[model samples]
Target: MFASVFVIALGLCYCSRASSQSSLGLPRLFGPSEALVKTAIEMNCELLTFPEDEPILLQLFREGNHSRLFAEYTSLEGEVADLPVYVQPYHEGNLECVARAQNNSLIEPTVSNIHYLKVIEPVKGAEIEVRSGSVDLFEGNMLELRCKLKAGNHVSYKWLLNGRLVSQSLLHDDRLLINRTTSQDSGSYRCVASNSFNQTDFFTSNSTEVVITVREPVKGAEIEVRSGSVDLFEGNMLELRCKLKAGNHVSYKWLLNGQLVSQSLLHDDRLLINRTTSQDSGSYRCVASNSFNQTDFFTSNSTEVVITVREPVKGAEIEVRSGSVDLFEGNMLELRCKLKAGNHVSYKWLLNGQLVSQSLLHDDRLLINRTTSQDSGSYRCVASNSFNQTDFFTSNSTEVVITVRDLVSTPNISFTVLKEDFQNYSAVVTCRSTRGTPPVTFSLYNSTEVIASVTVEEQFATFKVPLILGQDLGFLQCQARNGDNATYSEKIPLEVVPVGGPVKMPYTYDSGENYDVIGVTFYCKAEKGTHPRYQWFLNGTLLDDRGSFYYVDHQPPEMAMLMLSVGDSSAGTYHCEVSDSFDNTTAISSRRLYLDKHTLNRLPVWVVAVVFGSFTFLILLVSVCCGLGVVFRRRHYGEKSLLDFEMERMTPVYYGKLDLSHYNEDTDVVNAARWGEVDQASLDSVDEWPQIEEEKKTLEDEPAEEP
Candidate 1:
C-alpha cells in the first residue's frame, strides 16, 4: 500500500499541468487527502518522545496551496501537532510533516507517508462559452456550450436552457452538446458549476446567459386559443395565436375553412375577432413561414382546429305532447320546450311559475310516470346554455295550461216530486259526483233499464221521469260518467203514496182576548197522504191572497199551517182544505175554526179633547220655563245686564214688526246710562226696538199678578 501510494503520488505530480511547491526539510506527510477551502486541516509525523529522552525537534510544513510556483510555507519548531493548511487559487498538492532525533547517529529522521491535500473551493466565476463565435444556428446543426470557471476546484458542470436543467444525455464534463438540434433547443442557455467543500452544502455559480437562434422551415405548426378553449359564443372575444414547434423569425397567416383570411384581421401572429358571431365559426388553421432571402421563403400549413360559436337561446315555447289541455288521472304526461333558434341548449321545467321537482329536471321533455290531481297547473319550460353563466341569455317558454283530473266519484241520487196525476207521478231524479271534471253525463236507471240520460257542464245532472202508482220505480239507480271512468249510486227502491184519509186538524188555533195579536197559526193534516196541498178559507172564501193577511207554510207528506196576521177584518170563519197532489183527491177539516172578533176599545170625545188640551198646555209651560231660565242665565252667568235682557225681549224688528220711529237713539243711551244696567255699546248694538211707551201701555192692559 505504501509503495503504490508513493508511485501514484509521483504519477499525479507528473500528470499535473502546473508544478507543485514542496518543503525540502519535511518528509512524507500522513493526513487526510481531501479538505475544504479556508477550513483547517491536520498533518502529522510518527515521531514520539520518551520520559527519559529529550523531545525530538519536529515541525510541520505545507505547500502548493497557492498558484505561485516554488512558494513554500513552514511551521515553528517543536510544532509537531496538527498542521492547518489554508488554500488559495491553486490546490490539491502534496503536504509533508517531518520529525527528527535530538542526538543519535543510529536514529535517523522519521518520514511519514505521503499526505495528498485536496482543497475544494466554492465554485465562482462560472460562464458559458459557445464554441461557435455566433449562436445563429441552423436546423440539423450541433449545439455546444462550454462551462468555464475563473476560480474553482473539483467543480461539476450543469447546462440549463431557459433556466431549466438540460438533459443529462447532453452533458459531458463541463460541456453541453446537442446534435441535430431543432428550434425547441433555441433559448437562453446557461451553465452551472457546483462543488461541495464539506460534502454537506454545495456552493453553486451560474454562468452568463447565451441565446441561440435556430432558424428552420416551419414544421408541426398549429393554432392555439388564448383562452385554452376554441368554443365561443356571440359577443365573446376570440384570440388565436400561431405556434410552431420548429421555426424562427416566422410570419403567420390565418385560414378559415381553407380560405385565406385578410391580414387586417390579424394582430401580429395572432388572429383576434372581437364580438364573435355565428358567421365566424368554421375550421380555422394558420400557415407559418420564414424568409431566408428577399424572394425565397419556406412555408408550412398547420393542422385545422374547428371552432364553434353558439347563438344565444331565444323565443322558447312549450308544447304538450298529448295535444290537449286536460288529462285524466294516472295518465302519462309529456311536455317539451321548443326554441326558435339556438344551439347547445339545456332545459328546465317550471310549474305554476316555480321550478318543478329537481328529480324531474333531467331533459327537455318533462315526463311523468303517473299524473295526479296535484300535477294540475300551468307548466312552462326554460331554455339556457353555457353562453350565459348568470342565466341572462335564458328564455322562458309561453305557459301551457295542464289540467289533471280525478276519476268521477260515486254518484249520489235524489228525487223530488214535481207533480202527480191520479195514476202517473212526475219526479225529478238528480245524480252528482263529488270529485270529477265538468261536462258529466248522468243516467237514471229503473230495473237495469235506462229511464233517462242527461249531460251537463256541471258536476251533477238531473232527469225528470214519470212513475206509475202501485208499480215499481224499481231499484232506481244513477250512473255518472266523466271521460274514462263511470261511477254508480247504490240501488234504491221507490214507493208510491196514496191519498187515504179523513183529514183532521191536529193543532189548535188561539186568538185569545188580546185584541192586538200579531199572528195566529192554524195547522191541519190528513190521516195519510202523499204530498198534500192545503187551502185556507175565510168565511167561505178561499184565502189565496198571501199578502199581509196570512202566510201558508205547508210541507208535503206532513202538516199544513196557516199563519194569519190579525187585522181589523181578520175575525171570521177559518178552515183548512187538504188535497193529495198525486191523486187530486181532496178532504176537508173535521170541524170549522171560528175566530172571535178582535175589536179595539172605543174612546169618548170628551176624554180625547182633555188629553190633547193637557199636552198642549204642558208644552207651552215647558217652553215658557225654558225662555225664563235662558233670560235668568244671561242676567247672571253672562256678561249682560238686565237692561240688555229687557231690550232683547222688546225687540221684534224683522219685516218692520216693531215701530222704532217713536224712540230716539239718544233717549235710549240716556236711559241705559241712568239705569246703570246696560252699557252704551250694548244699547247701540241692538239694531231695533219696539216703541217703549206703546209697550208699557200694552203691559198695563195685562193683569199684574203676585210676584
Candidate 2:
C-alpha cells in the first residue's frame, strides 16, 4: 500500500507541471480553434519571444494582502530574459494561476498590464413639453417650442395632436412649419425626448387661438348748384347760388370759370357779380366740404351776354379835278365833293371858305353850275350829323390854269443826222416848241430843209428817223412852236454801223462733261442799237435765263452746243458748265483736258494697289519677327539648364569677411585655426577659403569704384 500511494502522488505532481507548461489562452496557431485556458483567478500576461531560445523565470511575493511577482531568465549565451504575469480574483472570489515556459520551469505570476471594465445604471423618467400646457397655433404662424428632460438623458422631440401622432418626423428640425394655411389646421401639439439609460416621460405646452378680419369703405358724395346761368347787361347786378344733394352741416365756396373767387364771407353758398360787363361771361361752379369729406362739384354750361352804346358820324372830302389849269374867258370847269363814312350824314358845299349850297346830303354828290375864268377858287364840303358836326375842306389854293388861243403859226420841223455816213442803223429825231400854246406846228428838214411840217399838240415830241446808209447819219435838230411863238431844239448826233460784225450768240453752257469742246462755250456779242435784248435757244426752243442749262449728257469726249441772242449789256466771254448734279462740275477748260480716256481708268487702280500692298507687307513683317524670337529663345535654353542657372546666379551672396590682421595675432590665430580645421574636416575639405577670399575682395573693391 505504501508503494502504491507513492506512485499516485508522483503522478499527481507530474500532471500539475504538464498542465502549467501547455496552458496558453493565445488561441490556435492555424485554423479556427478555441484554445481557451480556464484559470482560477484573473491575471495580466503577454507572450514574448526572441530570435533565440531563452528560458523565462518568475518570482512571487505578497504586500498589504496583495500578491505580486517579477520573473526573469537567463539564456546559456548570457542574455537576460523576463516574463510577467499577474493573478487576482476573476470575479468576486480569490484565484490562483501559474506561468511556465518551454524550458520546463514553473513561474510565479507577475502583473504586467491592467484593464478596467465599468457598468452603468438604467435610464429614468424622460419627457417633453411646450411652453404652455395646450398650444393654440394660428394656421400660417410659425410654431416654436422646446422639449426638455425632467430626468434621464438629454432627450429628442416629436409632435402629436388629437391622440393620433401628427407627422413630426420632419419636425426633427427645431421649428414646426405650416405655410399658406387655411382655417382648419389649428390644434394641440406635443413632443418627447428619451434615451436608453433613463426612465420616466416628460411633457410641456399651452393652448393657442386666432381670428381674422377683412376691409372696405363707404361710397362717394355728390354736389349740385341752385341757379343755372346768370346773364346781365353792362353795369347791371347779378347773383348765383349753389346747393348739394345729401345736404349736411357743411362749408361752401364760390367759383368763377372754375376758379375760386374771394368774398367777405365764403361760408355762404352764393356768388354775386356787380357792375357786370361783357367781360363777365363765363361758366360758374361751387364746392362744399365738411369735416367728414368733400363733395365733387361741376358747373353749368357757359352763358353769353351782349352790351350796346351810341357813336357819332362824319362827312366827305373834296378836291379839284385836274393838276393844273390856265384861267381864261369862257372856260368850262367844275368843283365837286363826296362823302367818306358813317350813316345819316350830310354836307354843305363851301367855296373860298364860305358856304355855297345848304341842300347837300349825305350821298356826297355835288357840282358847279357853270364856269368862267373868274370862278377858280378852293372848294370844300361841310359834313354834319344831328349829334356832331365838322368841316372837311380842300387846301386854301386853286389847282387850275387856262390860256386863250388867239393866233396860230404853221410850224417848220426838220431832222438832221448827228454823225455822217449812217450805215446799217436807225435814229430818233425830236420836235419841240420853246414857247407855244398846246397845239403848235412842227416841220421836218432834210438836205432840202423844211421838207415836212406837222401840228404839235404838246410842248415837245419825238419822231423816228430812218437812216440812208451814207447820207442820213449826220447831226439833226428839231423845231417846235405854239401859235404865238416858235423855237428850235438842240442838235443830236446819229451813228450807224458797217452792217456785219460777228453775229452775236447769246447762250452760256455751264461747265460740265457733255460740253467739253469749244462750241459749247461760245456766246454772242451785243448789237449796238436801241431796244437791244437777249434770247437763249436750245435747238430752236426759247430758253429761260433762270433755268435754261441742263446736263444733256455726262459722257466725256463729246462736244455740246447751245444757242443765244445777245443784248446790249452782255458782251463778255461765257463758259460751259458740265456736271453730274452732285455739285461735281468740270469747267469747259477742265472737261476738254479730261475727256482723254487714257487717264481716268489707270489712275484709281495704281492708287489702290500702292496703299493696300504697303499695309500687307507691314503686317507680315511683324508676325515673322515675333515667331523667330520665340524659336531662338527656346533652342538656346532647355528647361533644366534654365532652372540651375537661375539658382546659381540669382541667389544673393553675403560679404561677411574675417579680418586677416585680427587672425594673425597669436591668440585669435590659435582659436581660428582650431575652429577652421574642424569646419574644413566636416565639409570634406572643399576649397571654400578661396571663394570666401574672392567675395571679400569684391565687397572691399565696390566702395573704391563708386567715385
Candidate 3:
C-alpha cells in the first residue's frame, strides 16, 4: 500500500505539471488553438485557473481559422487566475479564444452581438404642393395640400400656414386638407420633419397663397334720410323720409348728417309735410347699400328748399264833432262822433283821455247828450293791426262856453229866526242862483242901508243878518259871476214890526157908567211905524182885529181888572220900510213903545175906593175887638149905668123913611139896605130897652127879663 501511494503521488505531480504548461504558458501548451473566433459563440465564454508552479498565456482565434497565441505571463505569487477571451463576429461563424495558466487555469473569451452601421445621405430637396398648385380660391371652396420629405426614419412632419404649424395626417406624412375655406383661410404653406436624434429639416414650396373673396352687392337697394334740414315756422309741421332702390330684401336707414336718426328700422320710405313755413329748408341726402357684395354710398348731391310767409294789415279811425253856436247855462248840448274806417271798428267815449264805458267793438257812431265843460278835451281814435298801431287826433275842435244873464229870476230864499222877538235875533237868508257858474255874493239891505254882504264860492249863497231894536227892514239879493257871465237871483223882501206894549184892562163895566167919560175900553196896540203892520198879541199869539179896542165884559175874579203882562218879547224895534217895484227898499221912521204896569192898570176910582174902604173897616174891627176888649169890659163894669145911658142917648134915631138919596148910587144897594135897617132898629129899640131893663132888674132878681 505504501508503494502504491508513492506511485499515486508521482502521477499526480506529472498531471499537475502538464495541466499548468497547457493552461498558463506557451502556445504549444494547448493543442494548436486554430479556430475562428465568432461572437456568435454559444452563451459566450468561461474562465479557468492554472496550478501553483505554472505560468499564464492568451490565444487569438478566428472563426473556422487556426487559433494563435496572443500573450503569455507567469502567475504571480505562484498562483493562477483566469483571464477572459473574446470573439469578433456576434452570431455567424462562431469564433472563440481561451487563455491558460501554468496552474492549469483557463478562461473563455467574451463575445458581442454584431450590429450593422449604415451611413445615410443628407436630405437633398423637399417640396410642398397643393392639389391645385395655386392658392387662389373662392369662399367655401375645398383646399388640399401635401409636403414631401427626401430621406429619414423616425421623422416627424408638421404642416404650416402663414408661419404657424398646422395638424397633419401622421408622423412624417405631410398632407393637409381644409374643407369649406372662408376669407380667414387665405395664407402661405410649408412643412417640417424631425427625428429621434434631434436632427431637424424644413421644406417650403414656392409660397402657396389663397385669398377668400366676398360676393358683390346686388341692385334694388334703398337709401334713407333722417331728420332732414327744414325751415319750420313756430306753428308748422316737418317730415323726413327714406329713399330705396326698390327691390327685394331692400332695407332703409334715415341719417341726419351721417348719424342714424332713429332706432326704428324704416320699412316705408316716404315722409309727409303739413303747415309749411320758411324754416323748413335745408340739404338732404340718402344712402343705399346691400348684402350682395356691393359698396354703400350717400346720394350724389343734396337738395335745397325755400319758403315764404306774409303778415296781416289794416285798421280803423274815429272823429268827434260838436254842433251848436251858443251854449246857454243850464241848457242841454249835443256832440257826435263817428268811426270813419270801414274795417272792424270799436267805439269808446273818452273823458280826459280815459275809457268811459264798456262799449262794443262794432259801433260806428257815438253821441254825448247834455254836454258840459267836462266834455271839452281833445278827442282822438286808435287804429291797430297785426303789424302796426296808430293814433289820430281831431283837428282843433271847438270848445263852447256858456253865458249866464242877470234875468232877475225870483230868489228862492229861506229865512229862519234864531232867537225870540225883541232879543238879539239872527236871520239866515239862503239865496240860490239856479243857473250860474260860481262866486255868488248875497247883499242884505235894511231900507237904504246895507246890513250885511257875503261872497260864495258856489252858485248858492247864504246871508246871515243880525236884527235889533230900531233896525230897518229891506230886500236881499244874491248875484253870481264867472268871468263875463254874470247873473242875479231875485230880490227877497222882509217886513219888520215892533213888539207891542202890554194889554190894558177896562176889565169890568156897569151899564150905567158914562161911556164917554169913564172910558170902559182898554187900548192895546203893537208899536208901529212906516211899513210896520200893527198886530196885537195875547198870551204870545197874534190877535186879529175884531174891533179897535179889546173889550173885557167882566173882570176876572182873582186878577186885576186892567193889567198888562209884559215879557222880553214886548217893546221891540219898529221901522217903516217902503219898497219900489224892483224890491228896493226905503225906511222912514223907527219907534219902540214901552209902557209901565201902573199906567196900564188904571180904571174907575169909586169902585176901587169902595173895595179899599171895606177892607179897612174890616181890619179895624178885628183889631179893636181883639185889643180893647178887656179895657172896654172893665170900664163898662165900673160905669155900667152911666155908660149905658150915655150910649143909649147917643144912639141916633133911624126912621123907616130913611131916604135912598143919602147913599151913593154907585154903592151896592144890598149893602146900603143892610146899614139902613141896622140904624132903624137901633132907633126903635132905644126907649124900651132901659124900661124893660129896670123892670127886668126888679124881676132879675127874679130870673127872667120882664117885657
Q: Which structure among the candidates has the greatest TM-score? A: 1
At residue 116, candidate 2 shows an lDDT of 30
Model 3 bad stretches (over 4 Å): 1-410, 414-428, 432-460, 464-468, 471-473, 480-490, 502-707
- State each model's CA lDDT, in order: 0.65, 0.37, 0.39
- What TM-score does candidate 2 get on C-alpha atoms? 0.21
TM-score-sorted candidate list, best first: 1, 2, 3
Among all windows of 10 consecutive residues in model 1, the one with the lowest summed lDDT is: 673-682
Selected candidate, larger lDDT, 2 vs 3: 3
lDDT of 3 at 23: 28
Give the top-scoring candidate (lDDT). 1
lDDT of 2 by residue, 1-707 (tens): 43454433432222111123333222111111111112111222233422123232322222222443322223222122222222122212222222233353433333322223111122334334343222433234434444444342233445555444556543644334444333344444455443331133233222232222111111132323322223323433356555444333345665556666677524366656533445556655555554322233322222322222122233345554532344333333444554555546555665565666554322554443344434445565555543323221211122222333422323334433333232333455666544445666665555436645677567656566666532435565556655345556555444433222233333332222332221223333332322222333343344454433322322222233333222212222233433212112221121111111111111234655898798667556655665565455457665546435334323222221221321233564343211001111211212353443454355446543221
Residue-by-residue lDDT tens digits, candidate 3, 401-499: 323223223345656444435345666677666654445555555545656666666656677777443455566655544544444555665644433
Candidate 1: tens digits of C-alpha lDDT, residues 133-209: 55876678888889988878788888888989889999889888887888789899988899985467788998889
Worst 10 residues of 3 by lDDT: 671-680
Instruction: Output the better candidate (2/3) by TM-score.
Output: 2
Candidate 2 regions off by >4 Å? Answer: 1-437, 440-451, 456-466, 470-472, 479-490, 503-523, 526-535, 539-707
